[model samples]
Target: MSTPTLLTGRDPRSESALLLLSAASGAADAFVFICVGQVFAGVMTGNLVLLGASAAGVGEHGVALRVINALVSYSFGVMCCAWMSERLRWPLPVMLLIEVALLATGAVLWALDLITSDGDRLGLLVLIAVAMGIQGRIRATPTNYFTGTLTSLVSRVTLRSRDQGDSWVAGRLIAVVAGAAVTALSVRFWPGAAAMAAVVPAAGALLVESVPRRTSRG
Candidate 1:
């Protein structure tokens, strides 16, 4: 399908799907920081800085190791998404389905009390980081408005809104915060399902992406 230009029309379906994915990142990052460790699953800058802090000898006991692991694992996910999506030529939803599956597995592990030790923590971090990495790349690598740099995205949003009168860009930042808040509540009130539940938005995104696009009549 051609890219929907919001100057004259909009693709709420596609935008909504992307928004849900944004919320998933928020939820996943919050879950990792609060439950698993101090490192962020989606935000690489945080982990990188934390790693630097560790190098300066001013961080948690295992901070260096964990952040490095998360960084490497997250990259692996990004690589896999880029490679497989090209080789397999599957729909975007199918690729995100893989991410959701990985997220669900972590949820299951946590809910079942399977992640109870250092080794388990390592595994959980890897799982979530990989999933987040895929989330980070899926949009950037596609023919979409999503970009790696926030400055670029904001610039594009401003330029389009002014010239083309395109709809404002997705409220991805808000979605992330909302997801984090919900995940925090889930972790506090419903520990068993917290991990699994945190992934609801991602699953929702997958469903949204699976829907057939609407066609306009002449």
Candidate 2:
């Protein structure tokens, strides 16, 4: 194996924070997909809650099942990303293609009313989940939102730091917030297509820049 560069030397905490940030951003956008587009895009928590209700024989068991499908689909997307990352020297384009296809399909489904009932919604959720999964493994640290997991961001932000530290970490946190905000706006107003489009440029940047630039040390 080739020796990895310093850029790949990601600390555990930083990696975790980035991953969580990605997940949160993705989840925020997914909320729009699930609530407005009749799809479960990310953040399985919603689906899990619905599932618990279903297990209790609640009114809408379909919602729970739909969530489950989304979870599975997201898992598959992650796997695909991992596999592609290993197989192809350049994986970003492959990932972009996958997301674009899924978004397009979702649009068609939404337009056709094929995404009406719980079953239909479940199918769309799965598709979105897969897309998010691919997004999760984009770089050494996740550049795209995963949606399935984001609780880490809250924990990381609340954790006590010994000192003010360099602005690097602070800047990353800000980026996380900004990215999520943009994603939320896109998802809410433009739906999946716009949300994916918003991420595309960032994804391209991440692809071109192998490492995140940091402050020069004295």
Question: Superposing all C-alpha atoms, what RMSD in Å does each candidate have to the true structure?
Answer: 4.5, 6.3
**By lDDT, who's the top model here?**
1
Q: TM-score: which candidate is best?
A: 1
Q: Candidate 1: where is the Cα deviation over 4 Å?
A: 1-10, 141-170, 216-218
Query: Could you tell me the TM-score of candidate 2?
Result: 0.56
Q: Report every candidate's CA lDDT.
A: 0.75, 0.52
> Model 2: runs farther than 4 Å from truth?
1-40, 58-61, 87-90, 108-119, 142-218
Q: What is the lDDT for 34 in model 1? A: 84
* TM-score of candidate 1 to 2 decimals: 0.83
Instruction: Estimate, for each residue in 20-49, the C-alpha lDDT of model 1 and write its tens digit.
Output: 777788788888888987888878888899
Q: Tens digits of per-residue lDDT for model 2 on 1-218?
A: 43222122155444444434343444434444535443345555665666677788774435555656767887888788777666654444455566556655655666555656756655666666676666556645444432321344444556843333324444455555665566666656865443443244334334434345476889
